[model samples]
Target: MKKLMLAAAALALTAGMGLAQDTVRMGTEGAYPPYNFINDQTGEVDGFERELGDELCKRAELTCTWVKNDWDSIIPNLVSSNYDTIMAGMNINEERKKVIQFTQPYTPGLPSAYAALAADADIKGGVVAAQTSTIQASHVAESGATLMEFATPDETVAAVRNGEADAVFADKDYLKPLVEQSNGELVWVDGFDTVKLGEGIGMGLRQSDNELKEKFDAAITAMKEDGSLNEMLKKWFGEDSQLFE
Candidate 1:
């Protein structure tokens, strides 16, 4: 009877391993642009992260699919096995590292900036809008500013435009295009230094998936070495954006 029980456990383990390799579902928030977003024309996930994820999967020789998830529940869903990996523009920080393991950073450290209608808008101690559950939101919450958290990144900017918040704090890359398109209506808050919040953006995986993480890390390394990753960064972000050496 003990031998039979051992056999059953081994079978279950083998099956689980096979399932994991069959198809890797990459979870992402389809709201963050240049990182990840839904293409209105294609109605599909399309962005820098999406392109990077596809290449990573190809190099790893893993069958992969994309899954759209809300930002607030992304980590929880990953933990619950709703997806196998997270390719969202998640940063590698000690706080998040406690919950999930991260691959080598795919992108260099990115700065977060504050944007408002006026260049000198109050950002240090005024109401600041940020996407909920993001590092920018946490920064505002601890920086003595009243944080106005919204579910979507768009809504955070909307809050500032509508005068509900004094400024909106977010990734500089995400804000750059918006600021340009605003045509003087929106601008970076002058004198407010941009803050480098996290280590860098990386893929988030389950702690137990060490092998999977290694596969992706290797692929990312290859991309960096070939300079393809830098090119992608330039394509998504501007040429002035940071890049790996």
Candidate 2:
């Protein structure tokens, strides 16, 4: 009887290991700092999203691996099975929802808007740079600014600083660091609204991966309930940032 019981336990352990080994391949731009950018020196991805993705993987009992991809091709790569999920700081919006599934938002919606040199004259409707294929680009075009699209957030900021673009439209968090680093070359414009900015950031998944989506959604919900999510937001974005408010 003892031997039989031992054999049964071994089988169960093997089954559990098999389940745990079902790897989840997650993708990120790895260029959006404070969220999921690659470390300049170490060359490894690190940021709030990297940490949060680790926690979510733990909660879901799945092995997770991250891959870096260009922002413009992220969604298409997901659709083509280049990865099992996307944990980049992707905003949940209707247009994105139409193409792929998203986990419940981990970060709340904060307004994205134009920012320019603090001393520069007010924007008079010239070329503006935004991440290509993003909602910000759509809004910029709608506002009658000629679109100068870029592949990453840093590039957009560079465009503004180099005088190649008049302004940049991007998330407040991303813009904040640039404004500080630019030595007064960038300042947020007034009158941006969160509502028009769309929804908060969430994880992206293949539209057909309902089971994985459900797991991620539940994990995020638990984090929110237990205050873990708020703690993370505070650590990265400060207490007064809209993410906490």
On TM-score, the candidate that comes out on top is 1
Candidate 2: 10-residue stretch with minimal lDDT = 187-196
**Candidate 2 per-residue lDDT over residues 54-143, each given as its tens digit:** 998899888898899999999999999989888877888899999998988889886676787544434447788899988888888897
The local distance difference test score of each candidate is: 0.92, 0.83
* Candidate 2 stretches greater than 4 Å from native: 1-21, 118-124, 192-196, 243-245
Total clashes, candidate 1? 0
Model 1: ten consecutive residues of lowest lDDT: 188-197
lDDT of 1 by residue, 114-170 (tens): 999998888878899999988999989999989999999999999999999999999
Off by over 4 Å in 1: 1-20
